[model samples]
Target: MDPFHTYTALSHQELGDRLFQGELIIFSIADELAPFLNRTKQLINKHFGIPDPQKAHLALDEPTYAARASETMTAFERDPEIKSLFFSALETCGVNREENFYDRLVLRIVPCVTSYDKGRQASVKHHRDTWGSNIDSQINWWLPIFPLRKARSIALYPDYWNKKVANTTSDWSFSRYLAEKKATPSGEKIAYPSSPQALESIDEQACFTPELQPGEILTFASAHLHGSKFNLTDKFRFSVEIRTVNIHDVKHGKGAPNVDNAGNVPMYQWFKQIKDDKKLVL
Candidate 1:
């Protein structure tokens, strides 16, 4: 069977099962998803003060661009209405927003080769989300606020989906990673801190990088060995990333195989409860 498939009329649970089996599920833009993505685009525009967020890095220096990027990420996280749009969008893809929990939405500003990172960005290494979150049932939803045309923007090493590659999970911990990330000096590179990364070289020919439209959603198992290919494009890449888990699947061990992750972080409790929206640390 093809590893990548499109959404049709399956129930959310069925969708979860396919994703758990390491399938890349694609859902084209729908009604609720439009407003949700538009709201994110609006926030990006507001903070960066640019019509094309993909060029925002060119408008400011390293520090100023970082500040605006931080503000945009924080504002979207703090706004309750934006989150409502998120769940509403998920429902259109058949997720039972009432029954599942979600991690905070993240706005990724993947800078081009010419942009300066200064340790303010997420890792671009080949790794699995489960290496950091330690949650097998976690499914990631990836979308571009603008059309993505660059290669490897969100590349997946599908050959490594069920295959083992030497990684740093055995020596990593989320708490320590967070502490060190916070301690990184100004203008210093994070170098992935405590996040797990492939210690072995990966073959680029086996990678699959989907060039998704603005509102198209890409869902895949958090354990998939995915990472960004360097931004060779002249403009910055602005995109949205959301992570959610089915509690039932997590509890029943019904997700992706732990092919190689040996990390010690148990982040299941970090998700916001769907009912009361209260933070859980269990």
Candidate 2:
């Protein structure tokens, strides 16, 4: 995508509306730019020393665990075009940077093989990106490095902000679990929130799972619940995820921490009971 051209193409009002109503929006640069995107991916792989792209998997086994790559701020600083695209995605999103936008960006590449194996379920469980975060001004941008075919997709609750379950409880634990959908069925092996009550409040009609192609971007609020589905395709799945936080919103800001490490909590453990038993289907 021509960073400048696309940024100008997307109307500011359209961008604002996207952020206001839906928790997420998917976009892509023109396909004609595929060769450029591919070269960037190749460079990233060379810098990281990952195996050939053709051999990557999507399963979550020991091999999958070994497949991890990240680029620091310096990487962006090194390339002007990369920086333009990075900033353009934000500008196109109508981010109010002048209001002291303290957005942080991250780039992540997940090899396809990580999801290829039987035990490679990437259902990391639903959770808000804002939980325990002092700064509530954050959003996620997921851009797949390659095209996603059938079975490789992302699922999201379309109008999650409209759900009665949102902020229903002042109790941090109950509220967070409900918001994250990490709560399991009550009295079951898993300590999920009472499914009958929770499900009753959610709009079953608003759920959606959209498959993303290379260069496509999915942006959403930190409170939105989202996750990756098991890879059903033989091709490798790679993507660059960027997160932005409004710095002025920080109040004794703890800063964003690792999502994988949040499992130590009791509520997280309760959800895991369902996960361990493979009973969490919702």
| lDDT score, candidate 2, position 16 | 37
Q: For each candidate, what TM-score against the reference?
A: 0.91, 0.53
Worst 10 contiguous positions by lDDT, candidate 1: 114-123
What is the lDDT for 250 in model 1? 66
Separately for all candidates shown, the number of backbone clashes (residues 3 or more apart, or on different chains) is 0, 21
The 0-to-1 C-alpha lDDT of every candidate, in the order given, reads 0.77, 0.44
Name the TM-score of candidate 2.
0.53
| Error in Å for residue 102 of model 2 | 5.3
Q: What is the per-residue lDDT of model 1 for residues 1-282, given as tens digits with 9 covering 90 to 100?
A: 356777633576788778877789888856657888778878888988867767766677777777787788889888887888877777778777556788778777778754464455644778898988888888898988777884626888788888998988887766777777788874457654546778999998888888887667889989999887678787778777888887777667688889888875678767976656766444
Model 1 steric clash pairs: none
What does candidate 2's lDDT look like per residue over 159-267, in tens digits? 5554434331223454544654444332112333312122133443554656666756676655465555555566545555555543233333323332222222222
